[model samples]
Structure formats: structure tokens, C-alpha cells
Target: MTASAGVLDELDGIRWRERGSCAADPDGGWFEDLRAPAARRARSICAGCPVRRKCLAAALLYGEEFGIWGGLDSDQRHPLDEALRHGEPLGRVVDCALRADRAA
Candidate 1:
């Protein structure tokens, strides 16, 4: 999905989280667990999430160093975080990561 201005604006707070695919799941640990199986499950859920870009943007913006956000774990998001720190636009970086995710 394109990161429109309205969507970007919504990323300012925790409100966007309500729409995440993982929001309703009782076991929130799947996203934060270092175990491979849990991470796989989290990524699978993130794959179909409608607010993935928002999720990733928020994660990067807030320096979330743990958990799977927008289908990407900490390791996958590290470079993108570095890019953001280097002055890359948050939207652009998120879009690139999502594109690469789809291609993979």
C-alpha cells in the first residue's frame, strides 16, 4: 500500500495499533519472542495486516529494538533503522522495506 499523507499522519500515536492483525491475539509474546517458531508466526500474521507500513514506521520512529513489526524482526529492521538515523524519510524507508519483503 502507498504511504499516503493521511496514513502517515495516523502513525503519530498508538491508535493505529488497534487495526493490526495481532491486536486481537491474546498471546502478544509471539511478536517479541526470540524463538524462530514464534517469530515465524508473527511474520505470517504481519503479512496480511492492513496497517503494516504504519506499524513499521512507528517501530522505527520509536526505536523498537525487539519484536516483529510489519513482518520484520529486529535484525531485518536494523539497516532500515540506520537509514532512518542517517536522514532517510520514514515513509520511503518503510516502503522500501515492504517492497523487499514482498519480493523475498
Candidate 2:
């Protein structure tokens, strides 16, 4: 198992239960839609998310292979996911993603 797997296991339930921008929405499933406008719509919601960092961290920690995360679509999340899988520290992954977000 990846180093993050165990840490992720212990944190998953609690982390997710913490409020996220989309959690209370009636359309929580929107984040998983891969279509063009749907991904865009989901990102809009994520953009204002108070828990965005936590959400992105969880996605990387667990290697989520689909959907929008932290206002980032699959393409945007790929590098962070790869870094996590390769044992990169979560702080470093988060820092990189934040930098990329600023540059975008």
C-alpha cells in the first residue's frame, strides 16, 4: 500500500464529513460529471469552497481518478495524484497545486 493509504484510511470519514462547498447542495453528484459544461459548473462551486484544500488533499491522498476536485478537473488533478502515488509529501503536493492554480 502507498504510504498515504493508511493515513488516508484513518482520516477519510472525518475529513469528508467536514463541511465542503458542495456537501450541502442538492446536486452533490455534479462533481462527478465529466461533460464539458458540467465540469465547469462543478468547478464554479469548488472555487468558493472553504474546505477546498482539504478536498484536494484527500483526492490526492486517495488517488481519485475522476471528477472535479478543489476547482480542478481531472487533467488538473493528475499531476498531484501522481505525486502522491509516488510518495511525495502531501504538503509539497498541495504547494504545487496552489502554485499552479495561481498561474492558471
Best by lDDT: 1
Go through the candidates in order and give each one's C-alpha lDDT: 0.84, 0.72
lDDT of 1: 0.84
Worst 10 residues of 1 by lDDT: 26-35
Report the C-alpha lDDT of model 2 over 1-104, residue by residue, as the tens digit: 87667657645785563678787774654555576676667777877787787777777766777777777767888877778779889867887887678677
Find the candidate with the highest TM-score and give its number.
1
* Model 2 misplaced stretches (Cα beyond 4 Å): 1-10, 14-18, 26-35
Residue 62 lDDT (model 1): 82
What is every candidate's alpha-carbon RMSD to the true fold?
3.5, 3.8
Q: After superposition, how far is residue 93 of candidate 2 from its true place, in Å?
A: 0.8
What TM-scores do the predictions have? 0.83, 0.71
